[model samples]
Target: MFVYLWVLFGLFALHEDIVLRQHGIRFVFHGFALVNALVLAKVMLVAEDLKLGHRFQARPLIYQIVLEAFILATLFIAVHILEHTIGGLIAGETLAASVPSIGGGGMQGLFCVALILFVALIPFFGFRHISRELGPGRIKAMLFGRRESAAQAKPPV
Candidate 1:
């Protein structure tokens, strides 16, 4: 989760840089991205322990994977809102003013952000489900173990 969030937030930082550069503002917030990733990673761990999206466990693996991703994405959106609101409150802003514009700044922006997050989470959940099914450490060995030689690959008569 940390790696995934770091990559996602890193891209956001890059995008922010490009947009700010266009407006003659010099800003770099990769550090903030790293911190955000760490916070979100912790949140993810907690959410997983709580089984935030276990409702689809009896359904297909894809269903669980997608549902979990959506759930986690929604949680991330909520966390972002809460974090910004708290920061605003700390800065002496009113509750109404403390609510930051999510996504780009409006409903559509929020939707876009949620969609991106959900999509990004898909691979993580997919791999996690696969790993679980494969048993602990099995996927790692399958992925990293040496391939069988041609002679060893042959089946016995």
Candidate 2:
């Protein structure tokens, strides 16, 4: 699960930079890293808060939940890139021809499929978590920030 998360993170990073073009967003990397880190940190803090272990400060649920949505949005952008890239490569015979064959069914096909699944699942869980706890408005605010700027900078959705 940890390994998969890391892979998803890398794909998310690539997708954000290459596909989503979210360069205007501040602390993109920090936002991405904090989501998973804070979740685990929160669990530890909550455990410690109950005197289950050593001292650790629990972040407010609101903060953690907000960051999760931002991370999910970033991950969604990245997954969009990965999906189209794979689709293009597989659909184009000349492009697929360039992929070096391994043995049997070939590693490239398996690799591309695995990437798509990994990218797709991260956002699904992230969205469910955010929606269940924080509400869409909270998530939207975190992703796009305050209403004034969000309205001013709205991307053509």
Candidate 3:
């Protein structure tokens, strides 16, 4: 599962690199998608581990999952729209009718929801378990004038 998520991210990064190289633009919209996907995956995995959800059930848990999925979907679409608009602007090409239409209906909406859920669930179910099993460790840092031990200033005689 981790490999699959990384694969998806790698593919996006590759695609963005191609666009950057060919178009000579400093920005690639897919880069934003890649970052969002990482965060979304992490959040979903944590939520799932909380056992805050039940599959195919009409419980609050399920609803929360669905809502999170919805949020992911919106973010995905926003990434696409921003990418297309910017790409088009850079190339001096008018966006086609099929490109990033604001009022997409039915199938597109469903597809976005499904994509978001699938991506979100990957991290939610996988990482959450690992994170919980390996609890966050306390890391202490002594900086500035702080010292780990007071006993020893051996003179450099």
Model 3 lDDT per residue over 1-157, tens place:
3444555666766766787789777765555445656755565466557654345345534454455455545554655567678778777777673355543456776575557445655454444343434564311222234454546765558
Q: In candidate 2, what are the lDDT values of residues 51-156, reduced to their tens digit?
A: 4311222654444444443444444334444555676687874555534342124566445644555445556445645555786678777767755565587688
Off by over 4 Å in 3: 1-5, 10-59, 97-157
What is the Cα-based lDDT of residue 152 in candidate 2? Answer: 82
lDDT of each: 0.91, 0.49, 0.54
Model 1 agreement with the true structure over 1-157: per-residue lDDT tens digits: 8988899899988998999999999977689879999999999999989988898888889999999999999999999899999999999999999998887688999999999899999999999999998899988888898889888897878
lDDT of 3 at 129: 40
Q: Best by TM-score, which number? A: 1
Q: Give the 10-residue window scoring lowest on summed lDDT in candidate 3.
A: 136-145
Ranking by lDDT: 1, 3, 2
RMSD per candidate (Å) reads: 2.1, 16.9, 12.6
Q: C-alpha displacement of 13 in model 3, angstroms?
A: 10
* Rank list by TM-score: 1, 3, 2
